[model samples]
Target: MSAPAAALDWAQGVWDWAAANWYYPDEPGRGIRPRLIEHIRLSYASIAIGLLLAVPLGLACVRWKPLYPPLLTGVNVLYAVPSIALFFLLLPYTGFSDWTAIVPLAVYTLVILLPNVVDGLHQVPDHVRQAAVAMGFGPLRRLVRVETPVALPVIIAGLRVASVATISMVSVASLVGLGGLGRLILSDGFRRQFDAPIVVGVVLVVLLAFATDALLVLAQRLLTPWARRDRPRTGSVRRRRAAATAAADAPALASTAVAPPGKG
Candidate 1:
């Protein structure tokens, strides 16, 4: 067979295998449904835990600006550590259970999220902070009501990144037997040399990352209506440009008209 023909046949076989094995509705707790749920559970759990830890630390860093340098450095160091290496480091202490997976996942999330939280809060406009203070708002009230809302766009952006990272890393956890959908890829696909399972796992992970990122974007929009309201539309921009050109030409046209067509 030609190379292209061989590749096509192989793809067809993989698709057929996936279609046949994708679901197991009849078998209790043994198919796509459970695997998908498990994957989502692990991803969200790690993100939630990371939020609980990172947010406070981020706030603290914002409160004490000098601490930010060292704090960020430390987290970056942790972030640079290989996920697999971190997994092994924790395995002895936490064993092969879900904690081992969850801990590293959460730390990775925290590493990404902490800087975002701090930067978001810091990005709040000075005028806005002054207004809050002028209104007799205390520090805590200003933080919660004024700062957090304004900063949410950046914070949620960080979360979108962290959530995707967590999903991808969770797949690596399968090597230690704590994988969710990753089990299908590493355990079933690699061991059996099956393309379908690996393809399905990768496709699902990609879809989940997109879904999570999109949802966070929606949340950011909803939370920051002022931002959307301030954005200029494409039509409005074109109209504004046309108006400016007309205004700029008006003086030149007037000058030319009175200048006595002497040049002509």
Candidate 2:
């Protein structure tokens, strides 16, 4: 068969698999919904834990600049380690449980979140920090009330990245027998040489990443309303348009203005 024809056939096969497995009338285990739930559950839990562990340390890093280089290098090294290798290494200690998966994923999240968070805090204007100090705010209070709020946008951006990465890694965790959409892809498609499950898995992972990122963006906009103030509001845009329209009509109105005949 021609290459295009073969690719088309493979795609069709994948679609067929999805049609069969994506829904469940009686068999919950085989349905897409359960697998999706598992995927989201693992991904969210890992990142949430990671955020708790990283944020305080990240804040500390802003206060202690000397620690930044060594700490950054260590996390970067952890980030460079392969997921499968980390999973296997942890398996002996964690003993083939979800922790083996979750721990490594959480660590990966820390790698992404820590730097962004510290950088965010560092980026807070010196003037702003000074103003807080002048106003009698303590370091802790200043960090919580003044610094964290301003740093939220950058922190949230890091969260978006970490969330997407966690979701992708969670799928791969299925290789070690933890159940997620990855299980379906690896077991049905890759293992058995089926096409549909593989395609569905790949598509779902991409969609999940985008969906998670978009949600984080929405959260960022909500949490940081001040940032949105720079964006033109609908009412303001309409008023500007109305003002321009009236200005454009002014010259025409003046040209057509009537005067008393022969009065001059």
* Per-candidate local distance difference test: 0.77, 0.78
Could you tell me every candidate's TM-score relative to the true structure?
0.80, 0.81
Give residue 60's lDDT in candidate 2 (0 to 100): 84
- Model 2 compared with the native: what TM-score? 0.81
Model 2: per-residue lDDT, tens digit, 1-264?
Answer: 999999999888877767777879788766777888888888888999999978888988887779888988998788778888887888789886778888888988898789879988988999999999999999899999999999987788678767777887887788677648888788877889876777788799889978886687668757886754333555677675565445433432342243111110
The TM-score obtained by model 1 is: 0.80
Best by TM-score: 2
lDDT of 1 by residue, 173-245 (tens): 8878777888889877999987778888888888987887667656765676565433365568767556544
What C-alpha lDDT does candidate 2 achieve relative to the native structure? 0.78
After superposition on all C-alphas, the RMSD of every candidate to the true structure, in Å, is 14.2, 15.9
The residue pairs in collision within model 2 are 14-196
